[model samples]
Target: MNRRAFALTFGLGLAALASPQAAWAEDHLAEAVRHTKAAVDHGKQGQAEVLVTHAESALTHAEAAQKGVYNIHVEQGVSHLKAAIAEGKKSNAQGATEHAAEALTHLEAAKKK
Candidate 1:
């Protein structure tokens, strides 16, 4: 009985270890979105670099979210953030402003859900 108990405990531990990756991914994605939102709230266009990175991270997490939990708006927001980051890199305030507007669209989409 003791041996059986040990085996059961070991199996449960292993199972938990296997499942957290998806959870971690989801956590990472949520963090990324938070970071992107912060960048958008600030006027630092150069911070787009960080925003893009976080957006990508969020995408990875969103992908890992439970299969049925598909957040299309979040995905779209990430895409918009990426484009905004790129545009900000290439142009000045006006361009960044335009891209920021686009990013806002995606953020709004995500928030609507």
Candidate 2:
């Protein structure tokens, strides 16, 4: 095999290896966004307990998305989700709603990237 052919093969192999990880990250990020949106909706409805449930789910997926792919917006989104959960636990509907909204914004930004 020629050097050029070897280089091309190696590059393709690397790409193939990376594709799965990229797809996994995208899937997790999408889930996180979906859950965060739900949390925001529940928060708006003043359902603190329900908001907590969705926020926790969103947090799990957000953290998973961060495992191999680190984005600042996702990081911020995770933080907001945590805050939302905390406030929801305290039955602070307004606070939880605000935090969930913030999380949604950041998660959406991360998805765009």
Candidate 3:
């Protein structure tokens, strides 16, 4: 093939490969959102156990994606929130408040980025 044809073919092939990855990321993001919601529900109900579990799951999903390209702060924030919930459940009110503050910080950072 000519140089131009080769370049064009390669570019198209690369885009084709990228499209699926993008799709997968979208799916992961959706799952992360669901997990976050679950965490929130757990928190509201004072079900710290479930909140921590959901937050961890959300964080895990976030970590699986490309860090620089993805908004991982949301997951980080939720994870912290979950940590706080767990702490509260354990009767460590001060520790829970501290973690909640940290979670807010991460969430704010994520928004800035």
Of the pair 1 and 2, which is ahead by TM-score?
A: 2
Pitting candidate 1 against candidate 2, the one with the higher lDDT is 2
Which digits, one per residue and each the tens of the lDDT, describe model 3 over residues 1-113? 69999999999999998888766655655565566566666666666666667666765654554342466676666577667767867855556556655665665565455
Off by over 4 Å in 2: 1-10
Q: Where's the lowest-lDDT run of ten residues in candidate 2? A: 17-26
| Over 4 Å off, model 3 | 66-68, 72-113
> How accurate locally, in lDDT, is each candidate?
0.55, 0.93, 0.63
Ordered by TM-score, highest first, the candidates read 2, 3, 1
Q: Itemize residue pairs with steric clashes in candidate 2.
A: none
Tell me model 2's lDDT, rounded to 2 decimals. Answer: 0.93
* The best candidate in terms of TM-score: 2
For model 2, what is the alpha-carbon lDDT of residue 105?
A: 97
Candidate 1: stretches off by over 4 Å: 1-26, 44-69, 97-113
lDDT of 1 by residue, 8-94 (tens): 999999889767855664564555456555556543655555544554554444445424245676566556656666665664434
Residue 50 miss distance in model 3 (angstroms): 1.1
